[model samples]
Target: MNDFPWLSVLLVLPLLGAITVALLPRGRDALAKQTALGFAAATAVLGIVLAFRFDSGGPRFQFTQSTPWIEAFGVDFALGLDGVALTMVVLSVVLVPLVILASWRDAERSGGTGVPPKRSVKTYFALILALETMMIGVFAATDVFLFYVFFEAMLIPVYFIIGSYGGPQRSYAAVKFLLYSLFGGLVMLVSVLWLFPLSSRKVSEGGLGAATFSFEELSGMTIEPTTAKWLFLGFFLAFAIKAPLVPVHTWLPDLAQQAPPGALVLIVGVLDKVGTYGMLRFCLELFPGAAQWATPVVLGLAVLSIIYGAILAIGQVDLKRLVAYTSVSHFGFIVLGIFGMTYAGQSGAVLYMVNHGFSTAALFLLVGFLIVRRGSARIDAFGGVQKKAPVLAGLFLVAGLSGLSLPGLAPFVSEFMVLTGTFTQYRVAAVLAAVGIVLAAIYILWMYQRTMGGPATEQVSGLSDLSVREKVAVAPVIAVIVVLGFFPQPVLNVINPSVETTQTVLDRPGFRPQITGDVAENGARP
Candidate 1:
């Protein structure tokens, strides 16, 4: 453990608050909400200080701690933070508190349907805090078994949230989500079981070590080409389910429309990153040979998702569902960057995740605002909103333009890096992906024009402009998007070294990751 157990404290505060909230009286709903916000705020502050203290020149993992949990089976309760995981930790800490604040006014607000309260305020806040703990744990755990534990545990709270508090088709959507996610889990579990023995042989005399699940140890070893490919499938399947890539993504659009607005924003914006993060962490580091072996097949799939997601998005009448499909299209660029195997591609992919997080959050939150007023998410339901709500229109433009990766915005730099890198390795994939980018412009601009510029609908003309608090809620996110565009060096400084370390692991003999970085080193094209 580092001198300070800051990571543990950060993970535990929200869980402890959940307990405290449960003890408070029913009429103390305001007190419960305040307590939740307080814990989230404290965690955010800690995450900032941890970021400042983090040495950018250090090894891959830091602030590490380990303790034995199940010695007989060779599992331990271990935790650590790396530049990549720590970045996500900071994002989560900041976003969760803001989510609490965003939902503050709606405290104790009844669910969508007219039914007796099946869950108490204490229980609701408890689930939120519990979900936060698991989310952080997923990023921080170094032990493979521990990571799996946190990963599977998170589904419980989220499933209940959408099922109990969501819209009309909540039950159906919840079941579909469960089925897709569970299948992935079973596959991942089988892979983990196979990995344990192979790792055991490498670390000890045919016995798994207490520190067997530690990422550094596992990464230092190698696996056979045939075995590595099979293990990679376990992880990829799980991430694809979570990432909801392509043909497997049918669940997201339906779930988005059914879940509560706050939940939808958090699920799509923050939680979904866990899937991509897992691939970067486990599939890349733990199974580098397998990653290289599997790159082409997955690259093909990502291209399919890009064109397919965009085409589907263009035809959507449901506004919320339209926004949901855009995530699939955006993640296609991320996958292309990863498999392209260039430092620029992977780095751009990393930055894209952060950029996408902020932009998507704004879009979803803003749409939620519209739904509250219009009582529907149909694109045609919103006509000439700019006439009545100028601020709202402007905010949507900022988010939409960011989504389109307009130059001068954060995504542009990353997208350029990704496309440039992909051109060298996956030339045809890059070209097809470019078509997806053009579709990005078509769907985004067209959706904006149809909703914001036409004659004001008779019903929506009286809609009020964004409240000061709502503007305050989203302004920081927009500022981050524009600010990062101009000065991405700070993020790149952290990202480049970590990305280099990943490439080093992938370049070992007998494994080829299709990587290219001489351009950046030689100060040429890339």
Candidate 2:
């Protein structure tokens, strides 16, 4: 059956609308807003359509769209999706439109002439849509080289948004963020270029080689153990910078603190996942031997980052910086689960990516509201906020519980599965990572206690509860946190098959990985 290229449409529909919005006449702020919302809503609808038709049983790169793009380099515009990709696509769709709504009230974009800022709402809205396009493409890309292009392209709009619409230090933060990402990307590109000869099957006329960017094609190649080791680190550094993994992770807190909350939410919640997802999908799969070889080193760093991030979070007085640091800690759990190399761990790692996005988005959004109300992100700036804003307190509590991985919360199941899977493999590492859970409670609860409870400060005396619009905006996200916590079966059902498939490929005879669990508990089994 030849249906349309639904996935390509999903990626481009938003950009087309963005271009349309961008070209509209100046001062047409209202039209720009309408166009952005419509475009975003359309993309979400397309994602929903794709989800229903997604085939979980087969290989993921389905509904694929491929064409020759760079013939000289052998790079093709190939794209496809599976359950893992679908989960990410759905998350992107849900979040981007909500971001549009969240940023709607700003005077520059809200069509409020009285307080309208200097930037054009049209360009701002167009950039947001463009971002959605790149984000979706990053997940859907099947070609390693194409994936790299989309991965690096995402920083452009985000840098603009941060520099144009953020705090006084926005430009500084934006430049730093871009430079860090570019540096990492350049490293990855070097590795990707070197990988071509090993990845391609076709020999060139001059005894050179044709490049192959397709994952399926590259999977057949063989490389020396020594060479694989160096290549692995090339890709690792790029993703680590984005994941903001410790030492390389310094750019995140600054970016979050200076950028607008909407920008913060998308950057951390969705864009950050591209890093960990890359590790799972690319690093572990494409370089299995190197992955096994580097496991000890990466895991050691993961454990250190877990404790270090939580410790730094505890010390932060700025609420936004605190949240950002917790992301560092929380992502460490994902890293631990990833290297565990078990079904439960990998499944839970994917789940961690999904649930973390939701909870972190909620936290950032709520904190943004607080800043709007009190004009500060400092923890000491607010006291007794719950008394004045019961609704806000309740929402923040939901987000925090998910972060702390409380039972029956969205993150609870994922965290439990991740830790449980790890116990079967790295018992000591699992125990230490569990301590990360305890640190989670400390920073999250203490942050809430300092910011939400105690006596009301003079500034907190008269604030109102969440507006109807705000309530409507956040209601579904909170509901999803609860809903997914209860019935993750729908997603789990889809994710397991694909995860097992990857596990099988990596479990090839060539790999001597330190696997755990019983003989009967093989990856192929349910």
Candidate 3:
């Protein structure tokens, strides 16, 4: 026990809370909700402490813990935190509490009575905490085996959340989500197992010749190009599905429409980003040549997602589904940034992950409020909401602007950096991708005008504004969006070093245009 096991504490704290919630007596739903909220808040407080203690200037991984789990297989129970992982952990912790608050009423509403259900309330919160632990584990695991375990474990809680608590089509959405995720997981597992033999060393050289699944160990070794490409595809396909890039993205709209708002936030806002994260952390780092070789194809898909998602969003009749489609478009930007293979591009992708969480969370929650009040998610159902719920309309506009990457908003900085960096490498892809922004603006503004700017209809009459609790839940997200928009240097500072290390691994010269504005002669940083 190295003084303080922060990583283990972060992982275990939620499980402990879930256990506590589970043990509460019958009819103690209120107590269970409070208990769950307390634990989530405590975990968030710990996350804040961890963030403060983290040495941004030091080694890539801090708070490391390693121990042999199975000696025969050379497997270790290991965990560590890098800037990237810390950023995600922080995002997860912060959002969990807000999600709890947002779901507090919805949980009761689900029961068809004005009061929360005994068993379902406890189970929902417990599942959320359990899910949090697995989420933290996914980003923090230092071993490939541990990462896979956490990755698969994440699906269970989310499945139950969607299946048990969703709307009329809940079962269909849950099954679809599970099947898609399971297929991807199986594909990636094959790749995980194959890497063991490739990673094995000669027994005579004081090495464990059987196998090893440690990220540190595997990253240090090299694989043949043909083998690396196959492995890369396995990992890439899994992530692309999770990222839910085009063609494979069908499940998202249905899931978003049927699932509860709180669950939608985590599914779309946090879990989906794991795909892009894996692409950067494993695919690019471990198979540099394969990544470069596949860049043209992947880049093409990314562009397709941008345009396809945007067009679909513009045409959507269901409000929740429209939000889901926009995420598809936003994810396209994140993937584009990653494959651009430049400092600005990678860093922007990471920042976009964080900013996207906040923006999308706001969008989903606000839209949920509308759906709850009007009892419908159709675009045609809402009209002139600003007259009755000006506060809600204002917040919706804020979220929409952020999603559109308007200047002086959080997303603009990262989105601009991504396009700038991508332009340096794949000029045509960057140019086509830029069209998504215009589409985004159209969809967001058009939706706002239809829902908030018109004459108040019967559906909108006498609707209420945000409550104190709702304000408490949404204010922090809006504040962060504004703060980060103006001052992105703090996140950029932490992100730059890790991104530089990644660029060094790829070690390829990014194409530099003859006309330069900000990028130095080295074509490194802007």
Candidate 4:
């Protein structure tokens, strides 16, 4: 199993699919869709196989592959996965096909209320496949340079998807998204370039020979404190923007409002996760002392995002924008868990990433369906939809409740673990962050009441129920949310080791765990 190039196959299959879909005859849109879904489904099945084969108790990074790429620069085309990366990989693969299924008619002229794509439907499907390939590559990469390549490559397809296929203001939204991301990427590139020289100096000073862009090699270097902090800030700034944390989060609402629901799922649900994921995988692991130094500020920003995002969500008139703001809020929690630097906190953060993907996907798809039926994104455009489309309303309620972290739902367990972990250390921050949960309930329930409750408006009185295709699209996501809610241990088991490994970095020299009062009795430190 180890000898198999599982990661390569996973990456290439979707790329091949993209090429194949793009090459299909112009009129064969149905064949293009089926081909894309087939490839996505096959890739998903392989992802499941890869997950089952992962040995939690074995090497930290399994199914490893390494070969020279830019030898003069000491970079490698390395790919591997820890438990965290494995889980993320599985999440990415699982969602792509669902997004494809839900978006079956998205590119068609009569598909929905939104404007049809300016390009061919084949182009739309092709872009999706290309995006899928980049998604897997970003998670699977074990080299810093390679990760950066994948990270920036993601923007290309997304840019085209939104600008060509989105709503009226899509061009503006896509440009804004691109500019924000490009600024962050440019800033981070300075730090990435600096790393080689820094690593070389540290290695030579210690009697070691050459430097490398390999993650493992850079992680082992003893960088100067000030330099490390600067490098950390460079990387952290980029991730915070990607995470769309508070101040940097302005682009998301615009993009969300304009993007097609299918692309939106991958953007907010899976792609945004890259930010928090980078924080966990690179920020803390590669620069522990600097990470600890930045935690107070990061946590402060996180709390602000949580409160600000929720407060804004309550006032949203657009359904897509409402869900987008909630995501900003949810991301705050994910960031909080990450910087909390406890085993439970980090583990829960990872789980939250996965759960958020499903919950948000469900909400967006359902909202997309509503907009298709009513020809409006405004909240007031709907009322008493439950009277006409009971099944759709019911599912929306489930997805909404999950967003609020209702008990017995997937997000609840992860949210609980995050608070439990953080409270033992930063009690005040945790408490402030908890307020976001109450605010979440408000926005979610109020949105539901407005759209799914009340008397049916004449406009919505004839709203149709979810089609068989729509149901097929969302059923798997809702099932995972419920099943994981009750039985999260399997995923947790996979995440725990990586969380522990990350936490250990904080215990080294120059770093300290700040465990408070009675909570310290449970364990010395998380």
Candidate 2 residue lDDT tens string, 211-298: 6788776665666789888889999999989987888999999888877777677898999999988898888887889988888778
lDDT, candidate 4, residue 357? 91
Higher-scoring candidate on lDDT, 1 or 4: 4
Candidate 4: where are CA atoms >4 Å away?
110-113, 206-209, 521-524
Cα distance off (Å), candidate 1, residue 221: 1.9
lDDT of 3 by residue, 400-456 (tens): 999999989899999999998888777899999999999999999999998999899
Worst 10 residues of 1 by lDDT: 107-116
Best by TM-score: 4
Q: How high is the lDDT of residue 122 in model 4?
A: 94
Question: What's each prediction's TM-score?
Answer: 0.94, 0.94, 0.95, 0.98
Give each model's whole-structure lDDT.
Answer: 0.80, 0.83, 0.86, 0.91
Pairs of residues clashing in candidate 1: none
- Which tens-of-lDDT digit does each residue in 18-85 have in candidate 1? 78777888877778888887887887888888888887798677888788898865777888887778
User: In model 2, where do residues sit more than 4 Å from their true spots?
Assistant: 107-118, 201-211, 515-526
Better of 3 and 4 by lDDT: 4
For residue 495, give model 4's deviation from the true position in Å: 0.6
Clashes, model 2? 1
> After superposition on all CA atoms, how large is the RMSD of candidate 3?
2.9
